[model samples]
Target: MSIKIYGDPGSGSLRRITSAAAVMGVEIERVNIDLFKGESHTPEYLELNPHGLSPVMVDGDFVLYESSAINLYLAEKAGSDLAGTTTRERYEILQWMFWSGEQWRVFATLTFDEVLAKRFMGKPADESIVNLAAAKLRAGASVLDAHLAKHDYIVGDRLTLVDFDIAGPFSQNERTKIPLNEFPNLVAWQQRLLETVPAWADTKREVDVRIDTALEAAGIKL
Candidate 1:
């Protein structure tokens, strides 16, 4: 049975899962979910993921949501070293995944929604919300930058889901007004990771175009 993934192509949350699937040799069927139209609230989608979140995976009779969990499951299903070669390495990857989800992901989402997303939607960003989101983003970046300074990948010397977990959220840093130059290590890590994955380029290009249109429409030069 082919695995089914419900997601929005314009959003990077699900891109990480699909991109990982490609790198791990996991074949999947992608179902586009139009979040702007409230398609996620429809009964069909709610059955798969009641929270109405993107990147729901259905393999055979098993259904799962939450991008990180789906990524973990896909990694194990592929039986690859993405989870980590050793038990300790696997645990460390899990720790970073959780931190990326709880801290990095949250701030990334908030900043985009409050800042870049509003511009994309042809509205002005809420300065107060942007301030808070930017502060949290900087804090998260500091820790990540320090860690990346010592390591190429998040959990180990090689690529892992930990890298994907952290990379996915900040993939659009330049377009979203994220100041990557301030965190040199983090910027370097993100650059190398994206360049290493061939499948990521096209989707990233598409996202870049979207961000460009948004910024232009909002009269904000980047």
Candidate 2:
């Protein structure tokens, strides 16, 4: 069966699937939906993802949206251990992935708006909002760092889809200046995952290429 993913390279959410594909050596069609140009709201894309979000996946007739959900599905479809090998392992993986979305995503978005949006997109950032977000983000980062200090991976000693869940946003720390210096374990965990996983490196390079292509096509420089 063929798989198709619709997203943009610069998207943190979309990066989850693209990087996973690179790790698994999975062949999936990539459909660029440039939110920069309001491509996600167009009729065709809205039909595919009613929420008009990035990283929508279509496997045969099955349509999936939300990057976290798609990560679980992709692992299952590929028979990859990234899904985890047993009931408890799978449950913990899902739990961490869900927390990444429900809990951590808010902080990621906040930092993106306050740091990256202002710096890259020239959008105005509200200082009050940035301060609020930073406080919350720091609390969560500490807990994550503590967890990482105890375990090499989210579920077990192996890299799973949960790593992608946690790693994607951390990768943006340099760009967003999200204050990860305090979370050394979290920082080191991300570094180890990227360095050890060949597929992850492939995904990073692929994303760079895609971003360059899109930027050039849009006459935007970064």
Q: Evaluated with TM-score, which candidate comes out highest?
A: 1
lDDT, candidate 1, at 125: 79
Model 2: colliding residue pairs: none
Which residue pairs overlap in candidate 1's backbone? none
Each candidate structure's TM-score, on Cα atoms with residue i matched to residue i, is 0.89, 0.87
Model 1 TM: 0.89
Range of the 10 consecutive residues with the lowest summed lDDT in candidate 1: 206-215
Deviation (Å) of 41 in candidate 2: 1.6
Candidate 2 residue lDDT tens string, 163-205: 8887776656655666677788987887788799876666666
Overall lDDT per candidate, in order of appearance: 0.80, 0.77
Residues 41-140 of candidate 1: C-alpha lDDT, one tens digit per residue: 9998899988978879999899999888998898888898888889899899889888888877887787777766565566887888778778887898
Among all windows of 10 consecutive residues in model 2, the one with the lowest summed lDDT is: 115-124
How does candidate 1 score on lDDT? 0.80
